[model samples]
Target chain A: MKIFVCVKPVPDTAAKIKVGGGASIDPAGVKFVLGPYDSRAASKAIALRDAAGDGSEVVAVAAGNPNKGESEARKRIKDVLALGADRGILIPDESYENRDPLAVAKALAAAIKNEGEFDLVFTGRQAVDDQAFSVGPMLATLLGVPCVTDVVGLEVDGKTATVKRAAEGRVEVLSVNLPCVITAQRDLAEEQYPKLKEILKANKKKIDTFSFEWPAPAYRVTELSPPPEPAAGKIVGEGPDAVPELVRLLREEAKALSF
Target chain B: MSEFRGVDFFLLDELLTDEELAMREAVRTFVDREFIDNRAIEEHHRAGTFPRDLPQKLGELGVLGPTLPDEYGCLGASSVAYGLMMQELERGDSGLRSFASVQGSLCMYPIYTFGSEEQKRHYLPKMARGELVACFGLTEPDHGSDPGGMETKAVRDGDGWVLNGSKMWITNGGIADIAIVWAKTEEDIRGFIVPTDAPGFSAPSIEGKFSLRASVTSELILQDVRVGPEALLPHSGGLKSPLMCLTQARYGIVWGVIGSMMAVFDEALRYTGSRTQFDRPLSSFQLVQRKLVMMHSELTKAQLIALRLGRLKDEGKMKHYHVSFGKRNNCKAAREVAKLGRELLGANGVCDEYQVMRHLMNIESVYTYEGTNEIHTLALGAHLTGHAAFRG
Candidate 1:
């Protein structure tokens, strides 16, 4: 079994995000980490490969802007390798900062096809930064395979996989054939913290670099801005004596009281 | 709470290699998840029980005996890497760091350095895997600063040795599977690998006071505990062997205290910035600013010392007195930093919710362990002035 897991490097969720002059996030002083859900996908893919054990291999694939020799994408690939992936492939594009979900998916689909035959592809349901939720379905369409998104549970046997997802308060279980895509949710798999030995060994693993020419984005981000600061609270008074006035203010000035 | 970005005011991170940085980040993330976010330290501290589950988790992270060779299921990490791991663990709690230090430096290091090949093959892998917990028994009830006065005795009977002694202030003692017991023979002081399950071997947990509450401190009592000749560490002899083990642990302490300092300083800094006292945040006051400055300044210096000492150790140029210098300076600095952090927290300082108080209490134990602050000062004084102050 050959499994390919897609990963992306995003600004750390704890980073202090600021808007740059060009309507994009400021990169200065920000740390990048592997996308959280993508790590879940990598974990699941590795577990599947290990369970299938006869010459099975898990290859981590990542695509992003190398960002002036920082090579965050390559670093993320190394992280997945540390998580027990046998090898890695990095697709570096200087223009990736502006690429839409479709363009990114196209790059990944092309790279997966170029890497020879693969039995399964795993990706996060959505990257935390953009939350576009379109890449897994797009990649599957390009590869001509079925895809199950927001997957909370998965079991693979023989050439088929049973995927479980929640839909409208009910679990939707679907059986997908081999050579399909899996977009993992939070509960898809438990995160694996790599051992120090594996981390050291990951430094020695082979990560082949590849480049792809992405198609023109179908949409553009015209402007990006931080959310507006919240309004200050106005103390309406201290005791019950102020309640009638507060209620009047809520119904009139604040318009918070629909009753 | 936001992630800990680390306190690198002097840009000391630039000195670290990629692998070292990655190792630090890995341990830091683990500490956050297992120690801080889960409130394990607070719960265990309140319960007065060691976080017994942590050792296996840390073992899975390959932090136990991390500097040892990979053949024994260790990471064979660099000295700096190991120091960074200690720093991160101590940031979580001093007791947690103490556990790893005792295991790696005091226990595994002795076996790796002096034990016979059979002993190494028998114990190293299991110890590294955290399947076997071991404690070092060198500090006795009557002897601490002066270990030469230890009264533990090992006598030859048949083809084995009968050991009788009592060791005090032993970390991981109560839960340990084996003890690296140092007992005096007629020839010299020797080390023996005594299984805790052996007859007449009993480790009673000591009720701790206010310091290192999350760790177990025990009294190891051995009455005619017998072990085969194979239990002896082949190359260990004289008082110097145990002192050599202390050197390893003290080196880790030099890095570990810095983690406590960083924790308190970070907590205080965050607290002052948001805490209002006179229609302004406490950070706006000049006095509070001074305290914060001092904490940051001292923490930066401690970081530099730890990094330099780690580099020297890796280069094999580190002397025992060099480790003493680091232990003395960093421990004192950490203690003072914790004090100032506690002061800045004011009424809230005593609360466990703030964590400054926890670090403050934990640093007290770190200051006194391995080698007390006064002992290291005397060691350094003797090194510099060619005069021994320890006796007088």
Candidate 2:
């Protein structure tokens, strides 16, 4: 089995993100980490490969800008490899950053094609930085494979896969055939922290780099603004006399109560 | 986990190779997950218990003598990579680093360097995988700074040796399955690989240690312990052999203490900024700023010294005195930095919640062990002045 996981290097969630001019996020003082959801995806891919035992290959790939120094991005990809991926592929093109999710999907699809055939492809449900959640589905569509989104549980047997996902606050199960796409949710598997030997070997594994022609972004950002600040809470009158006022406020001013 | 405030004022990351950075990052991630959990560490400390099966976990990580060759199940990585691992481990806690340092520099190093080919094949791989735990027994109840005067002796028997002595202040002593016991013979001092399960060998855990609370320290006793000829470390001839092992451990200490310094420095930085005094952040005060600045400078200087020493060690040009200089200077600086960090935390400093107090106590042990500061200073003094100062 050839398992593929797509990883993204995003600003660490703890970093203080600043909106620069032209609505771009400031990179200064921001520590970059492998996307959290992507980590789960990578972990799942490695687990499945390990479960399959002999002749299983896990290839970790990332599509990102080359000019910003691909080492940081490459480090994120290496992180997955250190977790047990067999090889790595990096598609380094400047346009990949802040581009359309469709462009990223297409580029990732091309890179996957360039790496020969893979029986399965795994991606995060969404990158925490953008929450776009479009890349995996779009990539699956481009590759003409069956796609499953927000997969909370997955089991693969030979040519078929049984998956469970959350649907309308309920559990939903679906079975799909081989050569399919999976966007992993947190419940897929707990990410394994890479150990020292794997980390050392990850440095020795050569990451094959490639570039893809990016499509025009479907949309562009006009401006950026911080979210609206929350309003201060107002106290209704004082003691038992306040009950009627609170009820009136809830029923009239807030409209939280009908009676 | 909070983002670590890595004080790399010298742009040192640029000096490291891409692989070195990757290695450092991975170790940092592991440390953050495993040892840096203050709540768990404090719990273990309060109970005076080491995390069970820690050696196996560390073995899986390949942190045991990572600089050794790949054939032994080690990483075969550069010395700098090994130093970074030590740095990150000590940043989590000094006791944690000491556990690894003993396993690698003390136990495995001598075996790899002095044991026969058959012995190396038998022990190195298993030790690296942490399948077998071991401890080094060089310091004795009578001899610490001066191991030449050690009272332990191994007398020749029919085709083997009978050893009788006691070793104190041995890290990992209680739980170790194998002990590299250095004892005097009629010809010379030699290292013997004695199984802790041998008939007369006993290791008892030393209780009530205020320092290295997160780690295990023990006393090893040997009463007429007999061992076969194969038990001897072939290439080890005299006191110089064990001192070489100490050099390896001391080199690691130079790097390890810097990690403790970095951790406390980062804590102080965060605490001062967030803690308010007189309606203003404590960081706003000039005196607080002075202390922080002092710690920051000392930590920065120590990091440079350790990194340079690491590079030199990788290059095979590092001298014993070089290690002494680094170990002595960095340990002293780390002690001062931890103190400044504690003072900056004020009342909260002494509490386990802040954790600076733990590093403060641990650094005191680091200062005394692996050749005390005075011993190292005298070594440096002897090197500069062609006089043997100890003779007087």
Q: Whose TM-score is greatest here?
A: 2
lDDT string for model 2 (A51-146, tens) is 999999899888877678545668888888888799898887676555878888898899998878778999999999888999999999999999
Predicted candidate 1 versus true structure: per-residue lDDT over A1-259, tens digit per residue: 9999999888889888888478568887777888889999999998988899889999998887777555888889988998889999888888778888888889999999998898999999888988899999999999999999999999988899988986644689999998999999988998666778888999999999888977787887879878789889888898999999999998778778755
Q: What's the C-alpha lDDT at position B7 in model 1?
A: 89
Candidate models: Cα lDDT each: 0.90, 0.88
Off by over 4 Å in 2: A222-259
Pairs of colliding residues, candidate 1: none
Candidate 2: the clashing residue pairs are none
Q: Show the lowest summed lDDT stretch of 10 residues, model 1 chain B.
A: B1-10
Compute DockQ for each candidate against the true complex: 0.61, 0.65
- Output the number of the DockQ-best candidate: 2
In model 2, what is the error at residue A209, expressed in angstroms? Answer: 2.9
**lDDT per residue, candidate 1, B1-392, as tens digits?**
33666788777877997688888888888888888988888998878889888779888898899999988889889999999999999999999999999999999999999998889989999999888999999999889999999999999989999999899999999999999999999899999999999999999999956989999899999999999999899999999999999999999999998899888988888899999988999999999999999999999999999899999999999999999999999999999999999999998999888788888888888899889989998999999999998765
